[model samples]
Target: MSDVNLATIDLNLLNVVATVLAERSATKAAVKLYVTQSAVSNAMKRAREVFGDPLVVRESYGLTPTTRGAELLPALRAWLEEARRLVAKAPVFDPRTSTRTFTVACSDAVAIALLQPVLRLLKKWAPSTRLRLLTLDRLIAGDGLARGEVDLLIGIPPVMPPGLEAELVYRDPLECIVRRDHPQVRSKLTLSLYASLPHVDLALFGDIDDTIDRALARHGKAREVAVALPHFSSIPLAVLETDCVATISSRIARAFAARMPLKVLEPPLALEPIEIRQVWHRRSETDAAVGFLRSLVREAAG
Candidate 1:
């Protein structure tokens, strides 16, 4: 009926009025609110001024809602209940019962080295949890992690993008892999022999294959790469079928050697170890579900 200054209103007055209407008596409402009856009467007077309604009336029985109070009670009760739920504490993660889908982006090497143990742990602990994997692409990886399209990123990037946090999972040194019955290679690789053999070059990260070429160029030698593959998983099979030697990571090389007729040999020249790390946006730092998945990845790496 008139303009009111909402800033001057006390929300506790509404709670008092609602309680009084429910209890049907100031004395009883005051007891329920842990306040004196005078406080309840004062609250009802302020509520009448705010709402412009005689919210309740004394009756022969006890107290009865006026026509306006009847219309307001249901709405007030619903609003208060919703407000309570809005501020309620979040529920803890229960892996066995939760059917959450976690997304991860990584290279084929990481998938080969870590996915098995991660799957085993998931099966035992969180059977219903599903895993979605994406092939690593650096162009959109940082943005994907920031926007939450990708849950976790596991890779060997030289540096993480801004606003992302990373932790080292493990380091795997470079090694030479060839078929077990290779013609020229035997127990170990010498610089001259390694340079002469046809190579299967792996280019997972952009220009990453250049590291080997650069290292070789320093010694006034170069590798003759017969074929270049984009993924480490492809190198083992290619090497197994031909006389090609692939300079590959130790973990994937050893893994392939166990299953296929491949040999993992130490390289003659020094190569830097691949530092694999897991990265995430700081926004998910406190998310229990994402934390659970991150823990599983660390366990798998170990």
Candidate 2:
């Protein structure tokens, strides 16, 4: 059922109704529109009659929009924004002046490899923008993207969720990292030696869908996991003090080895490389801010 009475309604009152509901006061809406308060009050009366409801009500401090009024907000805002954009000259996204918050999801390994460098670029170029980095949890990430809770996702996903798009940005091979002083790994790390050594399994994330385990199982061999912990940053320190070797992406291993006493060796088993990607929802494909953030990520990865 609809309450639209076409004969007596003035279409322009819709703007007045939106403005009144937004400002929560007829006087404020009139001031914003540079019109008299009485004019706005009359317009509001006609708008209420047209809609057959009191769209806004007087509370103690201010007026509040009713449920029907609240429901109209998004479409009304979009319509008003489109109207403004139509009259504006040369609309473009200026990141330097935009105070936007961008969200990114990735594995701890990817964060260890790329987060700092990407933050450096963002701080230098888009000073006012903020970045929120969350660890990748595939189970809920797809829902987050759909609900606009997540902005961009980086790293390998077992499968791309529907309504999402991705671009492969880089690849890193799996490698075994060990302390330089490890007694048994003097020359060529052999499969028998690797299986014999204690292993540090990355267990920071809840799900344990590991490629290393799958690769090992394929060859009918299993490595003993001496310890399991979260965070790739701590893996180096963990391996430094123990006889355990950690299997991780080569880039993360290189980054850690460059700063610490760690050695990167190709994993004895033929484990597939990790493919890093930047993923976003299809609905955000044409958004300028999202485009800018994606470019920044691609540049940092490159």
Give lDDT: candidate 2, residue 180: 94
TM-score (all chains, Cα) for each model = 0.80, 0.70
Query: Candidate 2 residues 64-86, lDDT tens each?
Result: 99998888767778888888889
Please give the clash total of every predicted structure, in order: 0, 1
For model 2, the stretches where C-alpha displacement exceeds 4 angstroms are 1-91, 137-142, 217-220
**Across residues 70-102, which tens digit of lDDT does each residue of candidate 1 receive?**
888888898789888999886888999889898
lDDT for predicted candidate 2 compared with the true structure: 0.84
Which candidate's lDDT is highest?
1
